[model samples]
Target: MNPIEARHWISAEDKDLKTVSFFHLSFPEQRAAFEELIQHTPAIQVYDTIWQQLQELMKTRHPAEKLSPDLLQQKAAAHIGNGPADEYGVWVYYPWSQRLVHILDEAEFVEMRTSRNQHKITAAEIKTLAAKKIGIIGLSVGQSAALTLAIERLCGEIRIADFDTLDLSNLNRIRAGIHNIGLPKTTIVAREIAEIDPFLKVTCFEKGITEDNIEDFLQEGGRLDVLAEECDSMDIKILSRQRARAMGIPVVMETSDRGMMDIERFDQEPQRPLLHGKVPDDLSYTTIRQFSGEQRMQVALNILDYDNISEKLRSSIHEIGKTITTWPQLASAVALGGAMVAHVCREICLEHNIPSGRYYVDPDQLFKL
Candidate 1:
């Protein structure tokens, strides 16, 4: 808008992107005026050396009108690490980070524009999905789920949580690759969603879900719109399914068994029992914690064991560990898994009641499912 601001823009005769500009308020500009306002405090000093040097940092004037400090302070109280604050007594935090605020607005813009394109999803049945929020616990398969839902425009919102980083080994199946190695999965996936649909609503929990923080991750507006169990922890699987059942959101999963679609619906209907309403009647999430070891076995059994039932040592491997250490490749053989889940999501989103179960295939004959 201003002459100096104009310098931040980049243009090309041939590119299709909408251009945006970045500016760090000059010392003589608004930032300096703001510094004169706040009485110099110890905490304010620490922000200079660290946050000031970070790429895309901002020093703003007055209170952030869009993001209330009361709200973010409450969020930080719940989310900040238990370590010590910096020299200035001010700790780096989110909801205040310029990048994060930009992402929330961007995700919403992308989602709204994409959703309004009724030409793509001509079905009215999808309206219900608009308010649906999915909690994705891990980022590998969860990344696939997020991309799937975003591309298809299946849901109204998404909530992502992961406590790990992008490891070099993850490049094989993760949406990210070598360049992203070591970044937190939630951060990486948040960026991916923003890139795909800037208007997508993503609330990222940088921490992994545990008994301690699960409620914080839920955000209180509603039970998850749905739950996708992507984490490999057998214990977490039991907890997620139990929580979903108690809250009344259906759960969907896409597994790679040489390209099989495993769709497990945990009741969205009222007064339903947990596990497709086929289990205990008085279920609280805690009530179902007893299901850990056995549920893992039953679930593994449901997924066809590639090597047939495991013999002695192999039994221990699958019973206590992994069989397919490496996920399947993304060739036609593997993509079949995504397609099957897509079919299942269409059914669930469109009000079709598919019997709850796992679907699969043998490596030699993919797509048979």
Candidate 2:
């Protein structure tokens, strides 16, 4: 490394650790020394932001006590690295951030992380959702719902399934970037959730849900609190509902059309039919997979009430595989679906009175003549 480059690299490390140092030297002399340091102390240097924050928090917690900041820092230091911190408060480099960060220990992290959610979730409700596991199928539109749930801290864990990879076409609806091209949809969703809150457990089904794995996906290890079904495969959608119903797990689905969303409280009403009995309960998976062009269009019509969908979207459905590659979708509609489904998920998990039915968030309808 050149003298300037080596010094720049060494200085970053030195900033975090007081003992680490580098001698100013010529390019040639610095090369050997820099290489040695790189070989030996390879750990990434991270800022002590969490430590600083915790100290500040202590001051706020005891405003009238007037405790010494140094004393509080000393007390907090012992508890800092014990939980979520990287092996006891050790700093690590995060690729996404491209910077070093102190992974706050889990408890402190939770306290600070969900502090903003206080009046909204309440301490009791937050605890309820934190212990629940949510299963999400298909990461394209489901990406929005999963992200919304994560941001709200609505569930303790999330399981996602998607066999498809990120394609440029998905950008119109799926929240992703060109850098995510060709990556598995599940991977992108998982990374997004982890970046938001590393403590939340995330499980991925890269191959997508299948008959063989469907059972385990729903209740093999731990049953899901709610199932958010959003996938292109007609068969998987039906099959997932059957499994969720059998396991007494409530189901929620968002259709990126007319801002429509469906909620099925199968847990509360076990006999409740899938999609409000829009299609036959006994519809075989094989039959759906082999659905002809016209048959698929009819199914779409039945699922999304023909009368309620905008005329433009209704006409666009007929052009699938001809003028259009697939059903038309907009980022606005997809994002709205995500937020709506997230709200329903929280409601169902908390045993709120979210009835089983189809609801529309159509802005056009609301402002109609």
Model 1, stretches more than 4 Å misplaced? 1-120, 123-128, 268-343, 361-363, 366-369
Q: What is the Cα-based TM-score of model 1?
A: 0.56
Best TM-score among the predictions, by candidate number: 2
Model 1, residue 357: distance off in Å is 2.5
Writing each residue's lDDT as its tens digit, candidate 1 over 120-156 gives 5653555666766667777666777777777766676
Best by lDDT: 2
lDDT of 2 by residue, 51-76 (tens): 67677656555657766767888766
**Model 2, TM vs. native:** 0.80
Q: What is the Cα-based lDDT of residue 119 in candidate 2?
A: 78
**TM agreement with the true structure for every prediction:** 0.56, 0.80
